[model samples]
Target: MKKTPLFAALLGLFGSVVVPIYAQTVSLQPLWESDTTLRTPESVLYYPAQKALYVACINGRPTAENKGSFIAKVGLDGKVIKLRFTENLNSTKGMGILGDKLYVTEMAQVAEISLSTGKVVNRYSIPEAKFLNDIAIDTRKNIIYVTDMGSNRVWSLTNGKAELVVEGAPLQNPNGLLFDNNQVLIGNGDGSLLAVDPATKNVKTLGKVTGGIDGITALGRQAYMVSEWGGKVWHVRADGTTELKLDTTAEKINSADIDYNSDAKVLYVPTFNHNTVKALSLK
Candidate 1:
């Protein structure tokens, strides 16, 4: 049968709709940024129960013995509630919350804090961990995952016992971690995004090279917002395509460990050296 003009017109219209969906790119709209504080904020974790944000501040060097670090509580409207919500920590970096407990990564140990009283309840020391950078919780499995950047290893804690689970080049100084659907998503310091099967420890590369990825939060199923330590943000799509969303390298505004409010489509970014937490709208 011969191709008719009406058929060709319909085909063209269909192509136009499908192409844009696959080619869609993500962009950020600045919503609100918190006022600069004396605390050198490194990561932001959103608490849905209280609808607030918690920031981990490394007051001085990111070392084991630096005891000047603290955590801050911030409102969604970009107001600092308590600059030092918890104090006397050692170079705290990333955070994860489960139930009434908030888990945070210090130089070589993970601290468990009470959400209600804001007090450190217990500490889990990782003997071989060096520069533990990020934390993720497997709520369903009752497991906690953390990345050790200095050791290029990923550790898992179950029943209060921590063990090195994944290591070597595949992790490549892994810095950011997220547990979704029983899978562990990792962002490396060498700009690579990877997915790992927690049960089998099988690893798969998700996308091409990225910046020195610090924090990672899910945008959708396979989509994620990744923050680079050198002040850049990239939106990684399901098909392994990465789009640059924000850059502040020239200003030296470090986009450190980030968190996302999925329901509100908000991305919370902590500027490590700038001492500020910025909320960007993804709507």
Candidate 2:
């Protein structure tokens, strides 16, 4: 049978449609896991510029007196460059880097540490904040946002003053937060990922998970990777549906406050109680 022009055209059309749909399907491939030196690690931030990772370690309970918290600097190959790169903090959790400063969430205050010296330079506190869980910064406006899981509120800091952004009902003890452009992504305690407009304060449900969402990383347009503290990683698609990609709950390995390097398509997850960080390649 000779290949007809019409059949060839139809085949090319079908191939184009199928390839993109197949390419959209993504999964996690385990790359490497760090040593147990990361005690109670809660968050991992992949710094592309430096080609390294920052792991926030809450050595013990996230309480006011738990001053054993520290941040570890890890190489991209899952090696601990410095086990205690920065030490003597109170229950540090999430972290964000802007310029030469690293901002971290303490139990009740946001600690600003100088990246150059690895020393606490400033503290941003909200008198009523009980538990400050995550930090997200807007580089353009130089504003920092934080989530208070205990008080179920969201806040922003500018010019060294803290102000309420939103709280209560829809908040649901918001845990994970990501500041992406005009909208803020909040991972609620109720397992729903809400996208809130920063200007109008309107919110929209993007997706949901089985448990409280702890970490969120965007993978291009309308695609996201979210994690539950119970050790589940889910991929949220453009249609508001979710697929569980990884589950370590049975193994008791947490996936807390994960970060991704877009250029490398690698996700860096900090395992809280397991005391380690794992890297997974997005395939």
- Candidate closest to the true structure, highest lDDT: 2
What are the lDDT scores of the predictions, listed in order?
Answer: 0.87, 0.89
lDDT of candidate 2 over 1-283, digit per residue (tens): 4658886797788863344331367889999999999999999998888899999999999899999999999999999988888899999998998889999999999999988788999998876999999888889988888999999888988877998888888989899989875678999999999988877888899989999999988886767899999999999887788889999999998999999989989988888999989999998
Clashing pairs in 1: none
Query: What RMSD does each model have against the real structure?
Result: 3.3, 3.1
Return the TM-score for each candidate structure: 0.92, 0.93
Candidate 1 lDDT at 250 equals 91
Residue ranges of candidate 2 with Cα displaced over 4 Å: 1-15, 18-23
Q: State how far residue 163 of model 2 sits from its true place (Å).
A: 1.3
Taking the tens digit of each residue's C-alpha lDDT, what string does model 1 give over 1-283? Answer: 4658876787788863233332567779999888888368889999888999999999878987799899899999999898888889989998999878889999889999988878999999986877999999999878999999998899998777998788997778889899976788899877988889987989998875556789889876677889898899998888888888999999999999999998788999999889789999985
Distance (Å) between predicted and true CA of 267, model 1?
0.8
